[model samples]
Target: MRATFHLKTLTVAIAAFSVASAASAAGLDRSGQDVTAFLQDGLYAEAVYTYIDGDVSGHDNAYIGPDKKAYEQGKKIDDIAESYDFFRYGVKADINDTFSVGILYDEPFGAAADYSGDNNFVARGDLDASVNAISGGKASSAADAGLKIGQLTAGATQAGAAAANFAAQAQTATTPQAAAGFAEQAQAAQTQAQTLAGQAQSLGAAVAAARAEAATTGEGTNVEVRTESVTGILGMKLGENKNFQVYGGPVMQQVQADVALRGIAYGPATGYTTHISSDQDYGWLAGVSYSKPEIALLAALTYRSEIDHSLNIDETYPLVAALGGDPVQGNKIDITTPKSVNFDFQTGVNQTTLATAKVRWVPWTDFAIVPPLYNEVSKRSTGDDKGLPLVSYDEDQWLVELGLAKRLSPALAVTGTVGWDSGAGDPVTSLGPIEGYYSAGLGAKYNLTENWAVSAGGKYLWFGDAQGQIPTKTIVSDFDSNDGYALGVKVSYQAK
Candidate 1:
């Protein structure tokens, strides 16, 4: 009985790399429903910590003007995204042969971005300054000046032609006064032509100066997002052999976000600071598990419902102060997390080897966050009757993984995996700019004693090209050929 239980423990232990490999998949989804998987039968407790680091650097190929580009070539922005860390801890215990319970704590979603370097386009004041310089009547002013100049030139030309005809007539005129009148008109027409030309030159020069000034005053920005979740589960066994079970419970989560907009690319968001926080939002989970000890087979299917949050937001728009409007606004907003389904299966190929496969599906398209006042103001400004949300997902996401685990000794086991994610979308939001991923993982577990074990896992992910977009589907930046690494360490103890 002890040997059989040990092999089962080894099977679950070696597959720990599945969590590490999931760090690179769809929309801030670092945990991948692993909390449910972690609640499998056993008097077990474990803690896992993971670290993720990635960098995206590329030039902005979008043309701003004849003389300026979005982000200059050869100027690389390193560490645009700060490294993030995750910690999860859980405990599961069997109350009897037919009942089990567990609780887990984890961070499910987060994001961070900073643009601080001198070479960073946003940091260098390109976006806001550009908006201010051009949007402040400069273009219209220049166009008006050009139109006036054109009209003046046409008048001057007609007057000059008339003057020439008069001069020719003067040469054969009957009186000296008529001859003098013709000469004066000819000189006046020439002076008017020169004056209009001079005004056009002045207007052109002013536009150039304003544009140069706009390119010079922006500061960098820092954005941070955080979430915390707690889940509780109770499982009950059924069937004559107790091989079938069902588990479910409530989930609570807290979320907070702060964004500082400093660049012109953000448009109205420029010079604005927005914040939102929600606590104790609730969701639920349900699943069924089937196992056959004789064949060493296990399969589980789990569903997690979306959590809705009503958040009170505090926003400050410094530009509003300049316009003699309110600088700060307080309002409520609604946001929802995506619903997901997860499936996990494992079977023993032999006494020493096991095979595992897992799949996760998240309906991201229905997820969105729209702050009330911000939405109202934005729609009015853009003349859109229906306002756009602050953030939204355009498509659903999928993740698939396959792996093999082998026992090297009674106390040692190893595993390797390959995975793929279909991603949330191609042109994604700038806040969490990432595409799908292709990944590989490796992990090892060593049993220090009959009741304690330690495991470490690492994964490498190659991300697809990502295009970051604004609310109106404008592509601001492209991240090509980016990749990241995730490392996880876990420790577990089992009750005797």
Candidate 2:
């Protein structure tokens, strides 16, 4: 039974992640570019354009009992958003022969949102009954036991006082029948107290047993979840030699998030959505790069600071209206995306060959979502404080990329890359699309003249499947997804 409740909770977390995906895909990591250095020294007074497409899907299953009488069937949720574009135009100005500075404006963060309202959806009766039975049974048992114990103690004290009064009356009364009647009443009161006391003990024991069973059941199910983040960046560079440059600037970010049970449904139907939206947040990044133009070796190191945000989350449950379920309102949640360190290295193997590698580390262990806020909101809406349990998460990841670029001629070059990323799985929140990736692309530079050039390229990415464990049940499902494709064009004119 505990496993059943946990499965429901896992479903909630996964649903939250799905809703947040749109926001995360658009934020600071927009277009999967990581192209900061690519835009450096080579261009002055130039325009660059880009486009991307993406597709994602998943299924959920929830069980309510061992007999399979109470269960919710799995369902599919698909998403497709494309034609999203990013643009930038900037100039690189050389100062003297040893210094230069460039300013750029680009759309760094954005995403599209869509979820089907019907089809392949199921909300089982046993599922809702199981959830209510466990949660309600526990609460009801506790309240009943408390009230019964209080009443029993009060009755025992009253009976003892009445016995003393009857003893006093016995000494002064002339009629034996009257004294006997008082004794009989006192005995009846004592009997009632004992019965109530016994009932309270039984209820207390049942509550403890039910709670213990729930705890044991919670550890079996697996869950898949995601978060949302959108960011825009404007960067400026200062340095000389084009080989050594320092860049720093402000980043604008927006986030949206939600949580729901993966395989569970709310009312007489399948799943409902519950989540929160964060207000816009502001943050910054600083980095330095070094290139050996004479040797063909280029390396860059950067630090992206963490952003703290307060999200306004709403709780929705269809069962509440149909089955008179508990009322819940929207509340605020505080969350923070971790800081990161990135290293990129590229070298020219020959006049026609260039190789590049990159590594990025994010401190995911430092973040978590607090569930008490949900309880506060629930209480305010329902006049009861039966709060939802909190969920814990942490993630650490490593990424490696290898690419080769060959110059077809003085005015054109083609490049292709393959990468590997291994990190935490779907069970852990904050585990973005970095799961596993395979990619390849080609690019070209056209020299319009000795001082002017134009470049264009396109790439397709294929991402591997991401899966998570449901807390207590052996039930597992796929959080399957596909790759994204992007196209880019750039024009640059150098100063003599």
Candidate 3:
């Protein structure tokens, strides 16, 4: 009886072990497993978390001239815009040796805010007519003075000649009294002409001075518009093997934008107040990935479809508008954000090292926000000429990453990586923010048991200068930015 019992016990143990192995394998086939997650696991399964934050700023200055003598100084001018922020979070789970799933949430795109009002370019009534008017007036006055001077000088010369001839005749004996009277008249005429000529010279000198000053000064009108945006995304993944995976999710996006005039004051008497408000939008994304572990090669392609949105915009003006002020009104706008494509790849170098690369393209040229028809018909509508021009926004970007990992213990490991992105420059749109540069990251993982694990990591991204066009006709310069940081945490449980 003892021998039989031993045999049964051994068989049961073997069956249990086989069942656990099968379960683990099944878990690996789900969608959440990724190359990064796989590498983190080789180190150990540890609870992980991540976060990211950053900002961008720049300016545009423009000079306009109506004529050679009456040119406006820099008309459109915008100082460095308000700073921006970015954030993200991610989590992962390992079902078994081959199956895993995870979720990632982040804000991938954003915009800056412009608020400086130094130039009188945009504001109505800020236009300087003094220089142009004074310059032209001076030129006209100088011409008239020249004409008067010429006439007076000629008359004086002619009168002097006639007086001499009359004197000569008088000296020859005929009428002395008549000749004396003629001489007196001629002298008086000469004196009057000289006085008039002096007056004309004085006026001419004043006009020349005025013209000189106008030549050195510049004046013109300018306009500037500021806009800000925030995007939030949530994604879920399910992976069953190193070969196939799927991810899909929803997003919430918000934008707070405004158009205002610089170098202009707002008051009850001025009938001009700024338009300030916010708009909210929604979007979603889904995709799949395929990887080959044996070959140490991986490829992930993702498509983010576009989102259609309508904004309930509130237009506000001075209270005087309500109290018998100019035509004032408020309304909503309809706009659409563009879609994008993301392709990422990874290749293992050795047991402890790996290489990674990625490419992304965003179709922002299709983005537009337009006011309703009724609002357009309203005289109070501020939407006229507010449409963004169509520009080629086709962006082809690339990134490369190199990483090394070290095993600290049987159940713990650590990794470090560095990467470079070469793509941010001369972007389209007045407010599109583009940043590209170097990034460094550190990650750690811990194995809670044979079937459970967790991981955590942090990354810092340093961006180079970003450039774009502004409505002010000025090239926003000194467009440098600071470093961004991201912190991430994830946990995984294995069934086998």
Candidate 4:
């Protein structure tokens, strides 16, 4: 006989995972954009909360910018990954056996990071007094170094002239004793001059390097993005047994962001900043589903279209302004969120066990953020009149997860899962420098009453190694062996 008893645990586990699989996802994916709630047999509603934290740290590149030797020691970078959290709500109601209506809410896409500590990513003060102004650990403050170097060079020149005068006197000496005394004085003066000259050369190089460091790094690199979405779906049952269904709905989304680019990592693009005001946009989603309740089988495929937004922005690029580029104001930036696909499936393994699989894909390469003034100023350096976007990716993203759920008792259930996410790409943007991750998770659900259930879950992620780069694709940092975790809780109600 087909298994039916394991359905409750499987359903709860899937819902909980939809919330846990965020933050560490490739690109800016969050909440998994799940729609399974609408596939339930009757009335259902759920509220979920998830929190995530990642330990992302690495070393700065030694060979970035004209001061290639400044960071030879590759200073340590402090943890840049900031903790993130969000909420999701879903509600669904079946009208007869052939019609269903549902609404879902989630914070679907976002990013957060901050650069701190002694790394080049942080802004330095004047080369003489700034902490970020370092050159092979030997550079001093600008005032101190320049003064000392000046004194050494001047002293060396004086000593050289004195040596020449002494040698000339020796050449004209009338007595052997006088000639010996003059030659000895000449030798001592020449030795002093040579020693000072060598010292000046070494110190001069160090001070120049410090100055270069100060010029290339002006602010810490950081980014924060937030978005909220609400989707309304209406599903129709097909087939005589109503085992198949098709559904779609409109999606409303609001988004905002703040970004700053800094450090030798960004080269001439350092000291760039942008603020995108919150803007609301619309899109659509459609999907198909099949179910066999007797065997606890369900399969669904969903597609969400990209939303286009024209948002007001504020921007500043010191490099551009210094070069006499026109100031930009009251401009609208056009951004199109990436589209995505999610396929989810589950089937009963026995009377008390169920197996599940989820797969997701996003075309991250097609998405980018291009600030107008930044692009325009870039033409002076590069002949490409089209310029370049301030931020973009080189590859698409894919994620897969597999798991099993077991009903331990009539009112209790447990689940476990393993997942993999293909990050946007290696050598990713310095703001979010990770190549993707592998994850393991566990969840438990307990029915408080016949119609009320509470569930909790947690996931541990092992992040992949990657090189952090600037928009121009110059490698400036390295991150490896980083990790993170996620925790989630959900309260749900359903009536059949």
Candidate 5:
């Protein structure tokens, strides 16, 4: 009975840790590369599904321009993230005591959000000429100030024509008093023309300045990221007791994303949307594992290399072309996903209990997405020759999880976990608002038969307070008093 309980606790902790560990990681981390599932002893297969629900709300939020002033005020941006689901599957087989192979399918990274709500932050621009921006320009809320500026020019032209006609009548006057009156009228009309011309020049300058400033202000965005990957693994056992194993293989990944921007703060990005897709990107993973059956100790360290992709991207923004900006833009971009390292270990504390811990590091600071044309416009407008990224990370991330598992019966096991993430940076982009999280989880595993078992787990995450910033490093929004949770279930089967 004692041995059976220890085995049950260890097995259940390994099975449930995948979902619990991922619930607190950084960036679009979904599966946490749960290679442990692929390292099972024999012919093993498992499928797991996870659902995450998050709610974010904040106040006193506004987009600050490069001039260090509020460019626009925003209402509460709430319910930005809806519920999302993820699925993972893996199968492993042991050809012999010293050889094993496996394959896994999972979504390693992803992000989703819908900004359609009562706030104008994410809504399409009306391009109203009556609206004024903080930078002092007509139609400042609109990306294309050309239409309004054109109207002003046309009105000035009409005034100039009338003034010329009055001067001609003055030259043909029959009486000195009438001629003097006509000349005065022509002079007033000419003065008015000069005034209008001056106004037009000032308007043009103001509009240009506003456009430049707007490029540096943050805006509301709707972004979705989808990733699918297949990893093939081969493992070899070594040492006299076959206690050490090494594994590595090829990985193929597919990535896609759709991003849309809006709000007065976005300027040229307003009504801009793009679709990016990649079919195949190759990478590799290598790992070493050590196991001691007597003490129920298993330790593994894995490294996943970054994958580079040249992707086809479709860009669209009607206002951009209308405003003399490029709408039909570059078709391809080179992007690379960040690399990561994972170290996981578990040990038997006693006959009935086990302890587990995992630590993950991802060099997110090395990650960035910069569309070509967008970068060009940003460079010209912000006077930053290097340009800015559409999305990026300022710092690396670390996630740590510790847990304990115990078996109450031969068929039932329970585990509890606490997790923490270091977050990629402070004042992250509005696209991914939360900085980091602290999480707690509980899980239970039940065996229906000798070869079949199921486990369910739930985790609650407390998000850290964070501010959203633009390229100018001005605060545009605040995210706080936010929380989220995830629920997952896994079913596993072993061939007898």
Candidate 6:
């Protein structure tokens, strides 16, 4: 007979490494959407807290104009990645040998970033008529001023030409009566020319004054997004020995955000801002699992469906107000969250050792946030009525992690993991300017008693380099050699 080994009582803490994989994920992916807590043996309950922080900084593009009068481009952008954190709680109970139920809560998807320092992302109140800027007689927002200037100049030219023609007719008239009539027309034409010229000068002064007041007061670009989810699950064990199980449940989620677009990098879209009111919606998740206690093995595959939401959004664009429309518009937009697939597997290698692996995929390329007002305003510049969304991803995301756990003592276990995340795209959104990351983590779990335990873990991330692009697919910045970290702690209880 062959000898067999089971690590049910020694290496169960192997799940600890999976808790903080959120430190380096793609496409607004956070929390890793982990469901391992619900898979624990018997009645189990756990609460996990994780924190992430990074310094994402780079240089802004720069170009100076000729004649030494204009200098635009080549400036430094400060750290934009703000400190972020969240919490997760899960409780599971077995009603009998063949049925189980559980509830889980987690903040799954989000982002937070702010641009500061002397960069294009900040709002400047100074507009130079010499330089092509808002109200510089070049940008579309200055259309009214440009048109008025053109009309006044044209009127003055027409009046002067008419005066010259009438004066010549007065000089050559055969009769004094006809000459007086022509002379009167010439004098009136000269007066009209003077009046138009004076008006033209006044209009020019007014445009200069407006340009002086073009500078607005405010901070630079910034964005904050948050989401919350709660899931209720029911599982039924099938077949003899109850080794195979199928489970699924409904998920409730809420999302909200605030955004500000400032500075010259956005061109006419500068000073644009948006607010998304908190919206709650529903979705469903399904999965299947198999286990073999003799070898201490478990494998499961899960799928989460996309949730639909009607988000109420308010937007403000400087150009919209310039184009004779309300600066702020409030409307509702239809948005659907992305769907995902997750696979988890673990098995005991020996009496005191365990091996584990996890893989996750999200179709982010199919996701986009298209605010109606922003899209409509974009049509004038893009010339395509289809317009563009304020935010979107260029690629899907794939994350893979492998881990090992070993029992160090009767009541303690240690775990280690190495992971890789494929970011949403190479040239990602300017808001979150990192492509993805490579990560490594270490964790330990100590059992205090038969029903209680504590686990803590930390991960160090090496972010991948990427180019940041705005909605028009314009590359304005580059972020490279950046890094971040994630830390997590969990308190767990089990009654097996």
Each candidate's TM vs. the true structure?
0.79, 0.57, 0.49, 0.80, 0.81, 0.83
Extract clashing residue pairs from model 6: 61-74, 62-73, 62-74, 63-73, 125-215, 125-216, 126-215
Give the winner by lDDT: 6
Of candidate 6, the 10-residue stretch with the lowest lDDT total is 63-72
lDDT of 6 by residue, 455-495 (tens): 88989898988877789777767788888899998889999
Between prediction 1 and prediction 3, the one with superior TM-score is 1
Q: lDDT of all predictions, in order shown?
A: 0.70, 0.47, 0.41, 0.79, 0.73, 0.80
lDDT per residue (tens digit) for residues 1-496 in model 4: 4336446545543435555756545778777787877777789998889999999999988652344323343889988999988999999999888999999999889999999877768766455543223332333455666677798899999999999999999999999999999999999999999989866654564454344446655457899999999999999999998999999999999999999876545544556688999999999999999998767899999999999999998987655443455444447899899999999998888777778899999999999988887777666445588887877888899999988877778778788889999999987888888988999998888888878888888999999888887666667788988999999998989998
What are the per-model numbers of colliding residue pairs? 3, 40, 40, 2, 0, 7
Please give the lDDT score at residue 120 for candidate 6.
66
Better of 3 and 6 by TM-score: 6
Tell me how far the alpha carbon of residue 250 in candidate 3 is from the true structure, in angstroms, after superposition: 6.3
Model 6 misplaced regions, further than 4 Å: 1-3, 63-73, 129-215
In candidate 4, position 295 carries an lDDT of 71
Cα lDDT for residue 167, candidate 1: 67
Q: Which stretches of candidate 1 lie over 4 Å from their true place?
A: 1-15, 36-39, 65-76, 118-121, 125-129, 132-218, 322-324
Q: How well is each residue in 1-496 modelled by candidate 3, as lDDT tens digits?
A: 2111221111111111000000000000101112233222222222323333544444332322223222222433444334332323344555554545554443344333444444322223311332222233322444564565577567756655665665565566457777777667666655665665554444443333333323322322211222222222222334655466665556565554444322221111122223335555667666666756543455777766666656665443332233243335566566565666666665544443344554545544355444332223222212454432212243434445555555456567666767665542444333433445577777766667665656666667776565443332223233455455555655665432
- 194-274, model 5: which lDDT tens digit per residue? 767655544554454344334423445688988888999999999999999999999999989988766544444455678
Root-mean-square deviation (CA) per prediction:
10.9, 14.5, 19.1, 11.9, 9.9, 9.1
Lowest lDDT sum, 10 consecutive residues, model 4, at: 130-139
What TM value does model 6 have?
Answer: 0.83
Q: After TM-score superposition, what is the CA distance of residue 410 in candidate 1 from its true location, in Å?
A: 1.0
* Number of the top-ranking candidate, with TM-score as the measure: 6
